[model samples]
Target: MRFPRTARLAPPAPAAAGDVLAEAERLHVRLGAREVLRGVDVTARAGEVLALVGPNGAGKSTLLAALAADLRAGAGVVRVHGRPAADWTAPELALRRAVLPQSTALSFPFTVEEVVRMGRAPWAGAAGTDDEAAVAGAMAATEVAEFAARPFSALSGGERARVAFARVLAQHAPLLLLDEPTAALDLRHQELVLRVCRERARAGDAVVVVLHDLGLAAAYAHRVAVLSAGRVAADGPPAEVFTGELLSDVYRQPVEVLAHPRTGAVLVAPRRDP
Candidate 1:
């Protein structure tokens, strides 16, 4: 679909470090009378996993929507595959990227397999066998195969989360946008979800996942982008971005960030003021 003249497109860019894959450059978005994103800049190199974090109403989801081009940013750029996000047609964009919004609601009693197969709809004339294979592979990866024949509406919240993730995997887009993929997952499934995200990055897909768990972001993100009040508070490797001062300032609470004993990854936890 063609956007109007008022739309903001990215300034011509030569990829920074010659490695940018997908990004938002000074992107801004407003909702009705309220501004949700205030000129956010983000970048993810090929095969990198970017963890997005912020308090509720901080615009983490809004930023994700802009990145996926589902929501237009008011006055900045969102680029995918080195081009303005608007440059791609719907079908082209679908083949190039996939987004899993936080709330995916379907009142109909669709089977889990049916839901996953919907991801393959982006492609034209994709064989049923091929679609089924993709569906099966995704279900297996998420360990949700047992529920494939079950109705999505009948599954528990976490079960539905996993099944939805399986759909994104089936999409096989080079870029992925996930909002709270582990919101209701058990510990084991949470780890599995992160592993699947990491494995996707390893295979050259760029991933941006919204996460509320600071510890998980520190442990899994190739980089973390912390948003506070609609702007990027810190963007860097976890150790640098999740610092005590940064966290305390952004979160408005006392906190501590220490290096993990084994992996040297940064660890964060709340600390009392006294």
Candidate 2:
């Protein structure tokens, strides 16, 4: 599949210093008998795309949930906009951040446009809320405007994914926590999703995305955080954190990192032994 030149564009500028938007400090979380996060410290600042990448069960999703205030930390603190996440009322938090879960199962029969408009619920009855405009803009950006009248339950997985993303976009929150936003998308759509993330960051929003594709993380993220065994194994620029040795060690597989000859972008691939 061919990608647009935009895919090769330089990473977005780093967020300004002292502009931390969301953070998890010394956070520990457990689900039933399993501890999902351990003393993890992660931060998302305005104007940056921070990708959380790791092998399965590495706590990337768990950490994102904590940062989104969807899951509580057993210990330590989670803050959004410099205040405790727990302190923000649901409506208040919804106005400041948006979350896209790993899987969205909608059994109810709702039109695509209706589903996207649901994102504006937090702004309901609020002064100066442009519900229709936000929903239309989001659908157009996600390429779901064509199917606005279709039932969300009847759409394909990829289509549903785009619609779901439209909802998050409609929310227009400063902080976006997306879990596997491109998981069900095609090659082009995957790039589209990541490009949207870059666009959001460039517009001064903070994005924290859980990505399994190391290459995507390297290409789009201004900063990459590698999580392993419920802890951050590495955190820094993609070129520095995505070294072959570090990736191979953390992923428990022989992975190779190479630079694109022309673009100088980091490329990640797994080594196959014959």
lDDT top scorer = 2
Which segments of model 1 are wrong by more than 4 Å?
1-19, 126-129, 272-274
Clashing residue pairs found in predicted model 1:
28-74
lDDT tens digits, residue span 79-182, model 1: 88778989887776787778998867898888998888877767545333266677789999998898789999999999999989998998878788999998
Q: lDDT per residue, candidate 2, 1-274, as tens digits?
A: 1112221212123446438999999999999999999899999989889999999999999999999999999999999988999998777788888999987888789899989988877666665557789999999999999989999999999999999999999988889999999999999999999999999998889999999999999999999999999999999889999999999999999998999999999999999888
TM-scores for all predictions:
0.89, 0.93
Name the TM-score of candidate 1: 0.89
Q: Which ten residues in a row have the lowest lDDT in candidate 1?
A: 1-10
